[model samples]
Target: MRKHAGEVGRYIVNGLVATAVHYSVLMANLELLDFQSAGVANFVAALFGIMVSYFGSRYFVFKNTVESIISQASKFGILYGLIAILHGFVLFVWADWYAFSYSTGFLIATVLQVSLSYLGNKFLVFKK
Candidate 1:
């Protein structure tokens, strides 16, 4: 129970960091590069997010005593990269095609992705 609570808390904090990274990347692309396409922005933001989440999750969230940070991070990256791709797809499809607000689409996708990420990270990435 305690461990689960800690994991949840860590996930939330790490998510905030990832969100910051995402937003920063998006803003940079739009403001500096004039890339106004939401899909392209989403992809770039996801890459930044993955970088932040990899280190944050490995050291701060999961704290796995693994062989090397690179190995553990790569495994973690693979897991969340799958989730991020799904998130990007959903964001693009619903936001662009259905005319849903980007915020709304992102909210729905984050809820789904976060649930999957929690289980996968707890059981697979940092498992004993």
Candidate 2:
């Protein structure tokens, strides 16, 4: 339990950094780059976030350096890919169907992603 608490702390730190990267890419694509579609932009940003997430979780959160990088990366990719799809879907529904602010959709999707990511990383991707 104590060790897991430490891991949770590390995970939150890594998650904050990764979320910064994600939102930066998202805002850049939406505001600076002038991406026509928020959903597409979000998808691209999420890909970047996924990369940051994998590296951060591997080295900082879980601290599992003994495992094969290839094996871990493959599993990480799969898990995050599913997450990205769901993230995009939620945003798509909000922006496209309801014509709501993409920002709100982004928040909702982010909350879901954060929850799923911690659980998935702990139980599946970085499981011992």
Candidate 3:
């Protein structure tokens, strides 16, 4: 029980770090770079976050894993690829169709994607 609790805590921390990276890049791309399309900004941000998430999940969140880095990263790529697509769709709907701010859409999409990512990492990518 305690082990699982620790793992959960670490996983959440990793997620927070990755989410921060995601949001930062997203805002920078939109505001600083003046990206016209929310989807494009989101994709760029998600790509950066995916790289961070791969390393964080491998070394910090699932430290006991026996899988090789290549194997784990491949799985992470597959999982995050799908999540990224979902994120872009949600962001488009919320920001473009519903007239919400990009920041608001990002927050909502982050919550959804992070939940799915935790499950994917725990069960599929880093299974014990």
Question: Which tens-of-lDDT digit does each residue in 80-101 have in candidate 2?
Answer: 9999999999998998788899
Across residues 5-94, which tens digit of lDDT does each residue of candidate 3 receive?
998999889888888999899999989999988888999999999999888888898884688878888998999999999999899888
Cα RMSD to the true fold for all candidates = 1.9, 1.0, 1.0
Task: Report the candidate with higher TM-score, 1 versus 3.
Answer: 3
Regarding TM-score, does 1 or 2 come out ahead?
Answer: 2
> What do the candidate models score in CA lDDT, each in turn?
0.80, 0.91, 0.90
Ranking by TM-score: 3, 2, 1
lDDT of 1 by residue, 66-92 (tens): 658777777788998898889888888
- Name the lDDT value of residue 72 in candidate 3: 85
Worst 10 residues of 3 by lDDT: 61-70
Per-model TM-score versus the true fold? 0.85, 0.95, 0.95
Q: What lDDT, from 0 to 1, does candidate 2 have?
A: 0.91
> Over 4 Å off in model 3, which ranges?
none
lDDT of 1 at 28: 80
